[model samples]
Target: MTIPKSVFVVDLNYVVTLPEIDAHIPGHVEFLDQCYEAGLFLASGAKIPRTGGVIIASAPSRESLEAHLAQDPFHINGVAEYKITEFQAKKHKPNFFD
Candidate 1:
């Protein structure tokens, strides 16, 4: 089965130092959890080897997603910066589901 095709996409770059990734973990978890509970975040994590983070979610529009993203702890607490782009996607196997 294919996953639904409405998601908020974030390309992330860290601004905070290594020390802060550790310090920011708790707040990040809390805010991210809030996002999850609100049905905002679907899949999220670092883009392998810790170069950056990516968040996939559902939102009605770019503006709506941006507003939600603006409240994320990483953004609010200055741990990372992000660029948001809205997407309607269906990924095939290897990329996701076939």
Candidate 2:
């Protein structure tokens, strides 16, 4: 079988105040939901100190992923900056992507 595409570990660092970030949570969640439904996002959550968040995701290409991320409310509002790391999955549980 063909190998899957690279997975992305997205690190979001808040660029604005907590209150500003909080204001965009709802829209951000909506964006996350859409990504999950589209099978682009595998997992996501806030950081321990609430400074930002992290998301595990995959897409056909890095460009595709970046395009999707551009729609996030955080991005739109300039509330957070993203740092993306890509890796090939050499090992994983059976059907982990399923």
Candidate 3:
């Protein structure tokens, strides 16, 4: 069976302090890079107050996406809780990828 493409908005809420979050940033970034290389992540960044972060990604299924997210250092270390919302990307600018 062919899996449909699903877009997800991953909202990360810090469960620990900022210093704790910082301690794992390098690993988190490495994970993000891997996701990007695999065409799973579109964009990602921290919140204004550094409380957490957000990631825009696409996956074949929610389960698979969740599995991939579980590999993040933040998740592994229990430093943050992730709230994932799936949405349909019906349209986009022609140059949006540029």
Query: Which candidate achieves the best lDDT against the true structure?
Result: 2
Clash numbers, per candidate: 0, 0, 0
lDDT per residue (tens digit) for residues 1-98 in model 2: 34468799999999989998999999999999999999999999999999999999978988999999999999999999999999998887777788
Order of quality (TM-score): 2, 3, 1
Better of 1 and 3 by TM-score: 3
Q: Please, what are the lDDT tens digits per residue for candidate 1 over residues 51-83?
A: 669988777667788888788777888778898
Which residue pairs in model 3 clash with each other? none
Best by TM-score: 2
lDDT of each: 0.76, 0.93, 0.88
Lowest lDDT sum, 10 consecutive residues, model 3, at 89-98
* TM-score of every candidate: 0.77, 0.95, 0.90
> Which RMSD values do the candidates have, in order?
3.6, 1.2, 3.3
Model 2 per-residue lDDT at 49: 96
How many collisions between residues are there in candidate 3?
A: 0
Whole-structure CA lDDT of model 2:
0.93
